[model samples]
Target: MLKVQEIRELIKLIDQSTIDEFTYEHEGEKIKMKKQILTAQAQTTLVQAPVETSPPALQKNTAQVEIQPGAQQHTEVAAPQVEEQRGENLAEVKSPMVGTFYHASSPDAEPFVKVGSKISADSTVCIVEAMKLFNEIEAEVSGEIMEILVKDGQLVEYGQPLFLVKE
Candidate 1:
């Protein structure tokens, strides 16, 4: 639980620092923040970006988008590696609502599951906190968790993939 002033202070500190990203944790709360230095070209050329899917912020997934002068702008994202790696058989566990993701009931508790952990359809995999409500998320598909997509205390969007399960 970070105070608003604390967060503002962090933003100021990070802005002044040379680092582009920073992560801090204290008393069961974890926060990861990043700042991007966009050129005028990049800013003016970005396609319609979803607030939930800030593709450019991923950096690794960024593609070189070139727009000819006076031409129309269009969306052209590189195929996500997750899609390529998950293949056709993987099932994604998606968030039911927009919220902050938590890996365990408590920060000190063991995470519900990890990569390679087997799960039943009803097994609790994580929790999503929305509007002060903590909702336990179940692994709807019985399988092994191949990947955990969201980080602890990270904001998640409705229908966003949280885990990849192999059934």
Candidate 2:
């Protein structure tokens, strides 16, 4: 559990720190956090694991996003590999709620997609976990993965860009 001040401080750190993962605990509560950077977008995730009965963040499938401080900032990113996709920017796929984003269905598994991977409109691009429920994230448009906006296991905000795909 986190106090209001602690949450505020965490937000400040989130904004300033380039590191993607953060964790803190007190008393009987334990928290695990992770962040990642692909393109310019960011993603984050927070998990509470107690000493007993470690909650399965996702038992079926797990997406891991690691946000590190040294990761490149999206806004400051350069378009080095997107020469073919020039003149048109990648489409942004953002989160609809606050939760964890997973690239794979489970831990020790391959991600759903990789950079330059072609995705279709009905593709199951990723997963977002909220309140113990895992939600499937689909690509609304078809394109090539230009940039991964967020990291795996990242905690994402509502309407935050998750991936940038070039059409």
Give the number of colliding residue pairs in candidate 1.
0
State which candidate has the highest TM-score.
1
Candidate 2 lDDT (Cα, 0 to 1): 0.57
lDDT tens readout by residue for model 1, 1-167:
55433443454455445666676666655556565544322222345322113332232322222222234323232212222225777888887666799999998999999999999989999999876889999887888999999899998765578999998
Best by lDDT: 1
Structural similarity to truth (TM-score) of each candidate? 0.51, 0.49
Over 22-109, each residue of candidate 2 has an lDDT whose tens digit, in order, gives 5555664544444433433322223331111111221221123222233311111111121122246667776655589999999988
> Which sections of candidate 1 miss by over 4 Å?
1-86
Q: Candidate 1 has what TM-score?
A: 0.51
Please estimate how well model 1 matches the true structure, expressed as its whole-model Cα lDDT: 0.63
Off by over 4 Å in 2: 1-87
| Candidate 1 pairs with clashing backbones | none
